[model samples]
Target: MTNGSPSESAISPGKPGQSTAVHVRDVTMDFGNGALAVSNASFELETGKFLTILGPSGSGKTTLLRMIAGFETPTSGEITVNGKPVDSAPPHRRSIGMVFQKLALFPHMTAAENIAFPLKMRRFNPKTIPGRVDEFLDLVKLGGYGNRRINELSGGQQQRVAIARALVFKPELLLLDEPLAALDVKLREEMQLEFRRIQHELGVTTINVTHDQREALVVSDDIIVMDGGRIQQHAKPVDLYRAPDNAFVAGFLGVASFINGHAVPGGLASGENFLSGTHAGDFADGTAVRGAVRAEQIRIAAEGGQLTACDTRLTGTVRDTIFEGERQLYVVATEEIPGITFRIYHHDPESFGLFEIGTRVMIGWNARDMKIFESRAS
Candidate 1:
């Protein structure tokens, strides 16, 4: 048992017949004052799958994750772990491991000691503890770092130690609460890959919560986007990015620009300029709608060139341009769509000189690239 291999029974504890690792049914959390932190959230995680809950601050992403970890009870509905209801179970009673934003490794303890603490607390056989600690240190790629104190290791190394501690006990499920949020951009990105590698190696079902969209896209098998205490959309990373369910999802996933207009037969129209794009919903003609487009989706050309193949075309004056190393951001001001500035990301700076501040440019995009959503503005 100490060789870092989990017994079959502990890996799928509680229910031997269940295929689902975690099930949340109509769970809701209320925090007094008629405030609801999580509203009617429901989802299921298959065994050994990784799920990330993404949202902005105060969007209930953390609240929902805590409910699954048994740290917070739902005001309504129920949660089940490995086919057994755990709504009433305490955090220690459930077979789950958690890595917090603060690593939480004891500075006084060595890396090996930190990993061994959990095994000791869980009452693993004392004779097997040393080998288990060694196994986890190697599992996290910290084989020779067992003797180093928490402060002696780098930020990323400390993270590895925290992860080793969480998994050394071989819990059936793992919960990560923005564990990489504090690291620098490069280190955070690197740790994302580390997490995937370790999770695949162990096949542990994981639920991570973070406000970083890029982190969610990089590390999650499935992403659940939450806002205002409600689930907006849930899908795989690629599908969620390509086909967002609404304007909120579209705006949140990337750098987006929205233009308000009335829905026409094939797209939305702002005055004489008809922006052709794909649309959904059953609104009669002349219904107010917004067309959402990513910055990279639009093509920019000097002057008004021949863009006969493009579904939508317009000429705008370059109001501002930002040089961002590999790519340049151009803010185009147009009279066709008043009050909405189009953002175009030009990756090939050689082909297009940083358009002067007042230079006029032509821009176009295929109809399919633009996503239309019904506007709730009254």
Candidate 2:
């Protein structure tokens, strides 16, 4: 993932009297006696906060979302919404609204009709539906566009209509399954901000599932990173990015470089270097381990320093450089660790002016920045 910093908006905690919006406990689902689709997933989402399930394809994020929306049943476990157990609740009766990836708006209906569909289904009086429709259309910033057909509106406008329709009934919880995936990159980003704004205004608890890590980080109050049907880490976006619990979480969240080493008597031993750092847990001396470091934590040296002769120093030849607008990325390869590369972010190129290909350079990170993960037996 790119390491550039993005704009962050403040997240609001739920209101004082709001109840727990959704409680998932020991939720596990399997398919045809095969591998688990979701395993022992548990979390409580307070009312009015937006939570995101972030994972790659086949990671069970969509399945978990579907279960919460009552489209799929868990093989075992319990789900409660507003303190009421809902494992057997039907989709329409759960008081949850959903916006699907395809928008699913009826092409023939006007935006007002689409927004009123849910209220109409509940046999709301025809007189009441129009007022509620207008209220939601205005809430989503599409009050004047409600008379237009779904086909006439732009993609972003259509998305707004879909969201208005989902929320018109004032459901207790909202589920968004990749609602912005089909839009262009620029529109997708704009809609992320818009979605957050709407969530705040409506004060509805929301759960979104998406594969885009950047999107998750931008809009979610908390992120649940999943892999192979189990949650790898659950925390605020910044915490997950900075201090992932394991190698998978570290590698999946953002750009990271791993240093394979063993804890020796003095420090960590890898190739010709021995570096010192805090370990996650107690391990025997000479125990195999892997150290993780973020690209931004590494510093490039021009002349000489203590790292030059220590185990923390990694001498490599610059192999490639990528110039982003504000920062440059250097990919360096060392003889001691052939095929392994380190990525360093340079803010001021003139400080250590751009290095040409094949220029030998040494890179090092602070001992405190290193994270050691115990190597598992293969």
Global lDDT scores for all candidate models: 0.87, 0.82
Assess candidate 2 and give its TM-score to the true structure: 0.89
Q: Pick the candidate with the highest TM-score.
A: 1
Superposed model 2: Cα runs more than 4 Å off: 1-18, 264-267, 303-311, 348-352, 376-378
How far out, in Å, is residue 245 in model 1? 0.3
Residue-wise C-alpha lDDT for candidate 1, range 1-378, written one tens digit per residue:
325354332564434334788899999999895869999999998888889999999999999988888888899999888878875566676678999989888999999999999888889899989988887888889999999988999999999999999998888889999999899999999999999988877778899999999999998999999998999899999999998888888999988889889999889988888999889667788988888999999988888677767888888899999998789999998767778899889997877667889998898999998998888754
lDDT of 2 by residue, 245-354 (tens): 77777778767788788987545778767766557667898899887777887777653544553336677888898987688888988766776898888777656578
**Model 2 steric clash pairs:** 274-311
The local lDDT score (0 to 100) that residue 94 gets in candidate 1 is 67
Query: Which RMSD values do the candidates have, in order?
Result: 2.3, 6.3
